[model samples]
Target chain A: MEENTTTEKIFPPGSVGLVKSQDFHFAPGEVLELDCGRTLRDVTIRFETYGTLNADKSNVILVEHALTGDAHLAGYHTAADKKPGWWEEMVGPGKPFDTNKFFIICSNILGGCSGTTGPGSPDPDTGKPYHMDFPVITISDMVRAQKHLIDHLGIKKLLAVAGGSMGGMLAIQWPISYPDVVESCLAIATSSKISPQSIAFNWIGREAIMSDPTWNNGDYTEQPQKGLSIARMLAHVTYLSDQSMSRKFGRKLQTAEDYSFKFDMDFSVESYLNHQGTRFVERFDANSYLYITRAIDYFDVSDSADGDEHKVFEKVKCPFLVVSFSSDWLFPPYQAKELTRLLLENGNDVTYCDIKSHYGHDAFLLEYETLGKLVDNFLDNIYKEKEGK
Target chain B: MKIAHNPSDSEPILSRSDLVMIADMIPENAKVLDLGCGSGRLLRVLKARKNARIMGVELDQEKLIQCMERGVPVIQADLNEPLSLFADASYDYVILSRTLQAVKRPDLILQEMLRIGGKGIISIMNFGQLDARMQMLKGHMPVTKRLPLKWYDTPNIHPGMLSDFRDMCREKGIKILKELPVSQHRDFLRFLAPVCPNLFASNAIFVISK
Candidate 1:
């Protein structure tokens, strides 16, 4: 087992330690009926599990990852790895998710380009990448695929379905789609429906991707690096706030004392976004990005109820812990509050908080201490209540 | 459906005397919403003793965490802002204990409270109490055990006399369901509170309805 080191701790305390991702291939005859009226076969889900699933399988917490996040939620795949996981701060033996107490499972989302089967994966029938032929998947479709994975584990009900951002949308969808399968939900920095502003940003991102000649309409052998990078750069701006950007970069020039005056990434913020864009294209697929953002834009938890957001949650019985950040303009606190309001009006248990942070939508991943405590207490209480029953 | 006639010996230590009185006033299994619920002490008490389904609305970050720790459902929201998130008549009782005076507008808060809940329980610290009067006479601001913070540093921007609350209720057509005057932190002259609440009581709990 190799150790991942980001800081002084070569082997960090409270770490879940070295873990490996496992792929679950669906058996024949289990066709996934997608929301877009397409049938998907030979589905494969890449997942990682931490801790132990207790007797009766009641201690499981299904962690859904945000856009660009994969099955590597915590721990390290190799000792030479520089980073452990996306949410290593909140998932460890004694951390917020508390592997000592509850079994944690995180899977790469369906429309993802990680180890999971996605647009980048070879189509079973064609023996070639699905590319643009990949049927549009929704957040509910992702949850449905996860449900199959959960059933394959022989778990009847999850202790909680937890996630942030697009992951939060999955968390919100789980209980509504399969109320009996979820005990509770933790939705952080997400809205039940994508706002128009967010949809517009996604539009620009897709435009940037499709406009690239290398994209070849998602059929190129080589990845559309420039278009994907630009898309990632544009998407990254939405994840951060103006206050955060100002505080982090201000008007400081990157590696330059004097202004270039031309279009030469003079500002530190520009350089940072450029770096983010460059790094993203190396890991993510252009087609997967298109599919995932479209899935997010198409997500509306209230779609089944004639656009009545309140009525959509009529079948949901589980409690919710909805959290948003003070500076997150993308999925603002008011949107989370509106979701909470609808849940409350429908007579459901909902706990909410607009955490005071400058981290914007990314606060869900950064504000570990505050966010961790909230998650810890919520999961602890839910576990206790489950045990008592 | 079973109501506790008296508080159990196992009540949480965070519960104050005034909070206990407010908890006692709530019925069994009542859906209660506590506005400015500091650390959720009263909500916990109601949940334990009365089997109430309780939620809290608190603005303070630390208190919001405390509420989560205590397993009480809470929303981090400001009292001065429009509480339009909660629908009308969604709760059995809405509580603003010991926090009415600190709000920007007590009248609007009371109306909101009543709108969301069937009954609103407001505990207001009396600005016209004898101790406050004595302090005013001596030309110093009141700093009693109940109202310990200095005038300059206090959050009590809209502090008012007990009669002021009654007059506002009357003007707004809000009925005073019950009023319980109570002394806080070992005050000696507590017995005279109910007799002459405006002049004697350190603080009073008013159960009002529209």
Candidate 2:
């Protein structure tokens, strides 16, 4: 584990070099109390920071990652790495996030297989991987653990909390959970509660992962690669829209003269999905997928406030920018509109934009130019308002 | 009577006399909501001159971006839908300028405006004006300066006369606090608009409250 003090000196002041991820471990006495009536001891958070923290620490911007994302939010870890961070287009020296002016921090969420504490983490009591023994965590629990990381960094308030999809869920939860610490929230392709259809899709993915013969009831020595791959294939379909699928691969053969009519992957779309599934299983854990999906399924902001969503959102002191893609069927525009209505009813400043896109739920990540400009303007306005105050 | 020509190069697209009249009625430092705020021109002017805290509701994507570019906070929403997001009497003024006829339910929108605001300012082009009535006599729909487009291309789905709106307000128990007639004609016709606004006024602006 690299210490914070040492990592801070790795990059010279005013340079825009790629920052490396570091592990921050809290002692057993500093356990994170979970909503499931269980506690996670010696919690470790893997986070990466971009840009420099200003003198007052008011320029901090916390970027939350989605269900399958890690702490590598921007820049390549090494020059040899083929790919940059997951959201590299939106966060750089002169990008919409503008690392030149603001400090950016992204951490792997709790119950995540990344460098965070999750099912893959060792159970201190048993001296083995927690696996199924890990307590079910909620989005609020993930946020609470992130609060610890932010406090460790000595940031009093974040200029903005932003994310898309599952990341957007955390963005919404941040202001509700820590109203005084977040100045503004930008929630994209997310909702206050998961729809029944979304829950059904997630259930199907979990079933695929658990039904594999090699699962060994969550105690297997070897990872459940087959089941995890199938589950990922199921999810990869939902991330793309029918229009996008057809436009990219419409009944085209996958390097074949004619269809073989067998169970083989003949169509280009099927081949693409298989490739995605194969690549995903290499980087993600099956047990972590089950736990994180469960956390998302159980998320409902109203549940924490006596079943009143208005009461839950009444605690939000910051303005919000709720964005949704036109073709995102999974987390559609109406869901975002409903959330915006609730926020407005509570007398909070909320702006909503149903961006026209055919990129489905992943539009926020794919359509960076439009999303980037809107977010840039929104953040610039917020910064100006704060300066005036 | 001298008719006003197309706006000169010096003026903005929103420099219509009716919009200017509406902007004049708004006080300084007020909390204002501009419904169907196309490109946020009125709200921008209000923010600059009155120092008002303004929010806008616009449905068009391009206009919404324009509003954002001008640093005006706007929600992308159709005016035909209910403004249930806003609390009752939350805004000092709610201005629906030149968009009443285009809505599906103008009466409900007016009620919602008065419900969510202390005062509601609505400006509508009168379909029962002299030119419209004369066109009706000639078996043609009017396409005057206020109602510039042809019937097929116009967005005014529910073209209403000034008297019709007054009657609707009366039936709904809404008090008309003030009324201003906007006319293109400079002298005699402009003077006659106040006397018989339903027949002579090209457009009308009404301030109402519940």
Candidate 3:
């Protein structure tokens, strides 16, 4: 928990307070199947719930996290904590997710470094870290694990599923995985599949870690700080747009009156990227990063449906709100439009909005005012439609 | 469908007569696709009045937000692109109001409308009207109530006459199921609009089928 202190300070405080993360474990014989033709024994999921579940258990909203996000969605675990959850602006009492109105559930994915079962988790047989032994997982497998958690909580169906980036991928996979259970989906800044360019970036990140001498074949006693920092630095560049970088840092010197004439982080942008990388290495596990990025690389919803994206959406009965940002080159607006087109072709009720933001891929996380209103209006409409029925 | 009765003399925010006539053509519970639906006003009205399952396709980013704010299901897309996203004859009606003349290819859009919708309702501004003809006779482009811009600043790239649309529809084997001529004229002029729509009607709404 202390590892995330630096990253936590970047976000604002939440309206809700005193929330705690809870762990749910399955017995040894209970197996969770993996996409790589393997089985995970004795799975455990660490999740946080905000707001009370109604008697009918119908007010549940499952929030999926991105690659680096965890289950701490809105409130601080303690008053001493420096910052609130990652989506603090979106899940409080009066926020878009609205803890007062809907029950919010966010969980660390199966292949995560958080308090969930991942490469960092101990193997039951050997009583050691799973590391590379952890079976490769898919987006659908992640949704299935969430479904198990939901069923254990006695919730029949979820009111909505939402997330951005990798979380957004889960949001898309939820309805496809459990078509009958999700009433609505809000997917932002996500794609139906990982593009080759993104996969190439992920591969480079993995290479940076594996090529590090300290990595020691995924069983390093000490953290692979150098390799992990490089990976994170590369990722941070992708998360931001050229415009955002120009506006925020703009080749300004980092407190140096003159050019350093050396490669020692002279530029403000370089210093900022180094800071991001250093903080990320402190919180995230290197092996977990490799496994999760590999999982994302394998994610293709259309491939599961024999290359017909329209067929994949034909089973979806819920309303969808697909959002993209104007400057998000990582997962561009065209990808969101493709998903929307497939959904529309299947006659599913879908709304697509391309928000005009210079925040790039991170816009979904930062542009809460506009994104919150869109989600609020969409959810309100769904509620009204249900009431009218 | 939910018409607001304004007692004041202020001009209506929406085109009341056009929307009213279009709403009259749509049946209850029908699936409707509205192209270039600005602010989703017509779709909202249709949802309230006709109980239609309406969707809008708008290109402008700001208007798309407005549509979402009103809880209208809208996709931000250019109507100039092909409507291949929809299955053929999926919608009961596809309405293109005050948008055909501004599109890159109105004929292709109409064909798509008839392919994706069982019926197509198009509202067009008649450039061959008497006011436009009078302006042309005076050696200038028209700036009437329908075409409300100077020649160079107009968004209407292909300002077409009523007869031109009819001939195109006839050539494409699309049957004109119903024609409604709209005018803001006195008794005698209003009476003559139906007889010679291309010469008299300032605006026209046509319901067609393949």
Top TM-score prediction, candidate number: 1
TM-score of chain B of each: 0.91, 0.88, 0.90
Model 2, residue B151: C-alpha shift (Å):
1.9
Displacement of the residue B184 alpha carbon in candidate 3, Å: 3.6
lDDT of 2 by residue, A186-300 (tens): 9999999999988998999999889988887788777688888888888888888999998999889998899897989999998998899889888998899999999999988
Clashes of each: 2, 0, 0
Residue B44 in candidate 2 has what lDDT? 78
lDDT of 1 by residue, A1-389 (tens): 55435543466788887899999999998989998899899999999999999888989999999989999999987667678899999999989999999899999999798888899899999999899999999999999999899989999988899999999999999999998889999999999999999999999999999999999989988889999999999889888988889999999999988998898999999999999999998899999999999999998888968888768988888889999999998899989998998898988878898888998888888999889989998998898888788
Candidate 3 residue runs with Cα over 4 Å from true position: A1-14, B1-15, B145-147, B170-175, B185-188
DockQ, structure candidate 2:
0.53
Q: What's the CA error at residue B86 for candidate 2, in Å? A: 3.7
Candidate achieving higher TM-score, 1 or 2: 1
- Model 2 docking tier (incorrect/acceptable/medium/high): medium
Candidate 3 docking quality: incorrect, acceptable, medium or high:
medium
lDDT: worst 10-residue window of model 1 chain A: A1-10
Q: Please give the distance, in angstroms, between residue B112's alpha carbon in candidate 2 and its true position after superposition.
A: 3.4
Interface root mean square deviation per prediction: 0.8, 1.5, 1.8
Report clash pairs, candidate 2. none
lDDT of 3 by residue, A137-234 (tens): 88888888888789888899888999999999999999998899999999999998999989999999999999999999999777899999999999
Give the 10-residue window scoring lowest on summed lDDT in candidate 2 chain A. Answer: A6-15
For residues B38-113, write the lDDT of model 1, one tens digit per residue: 8987888789878999999998888998998888989888899889889999999999988888888888999999
The DockQ of each candidate is 0.79, 0.53, 0.61
What lDDT is obtained when candidate 1 is compared to the true structure? 0.89
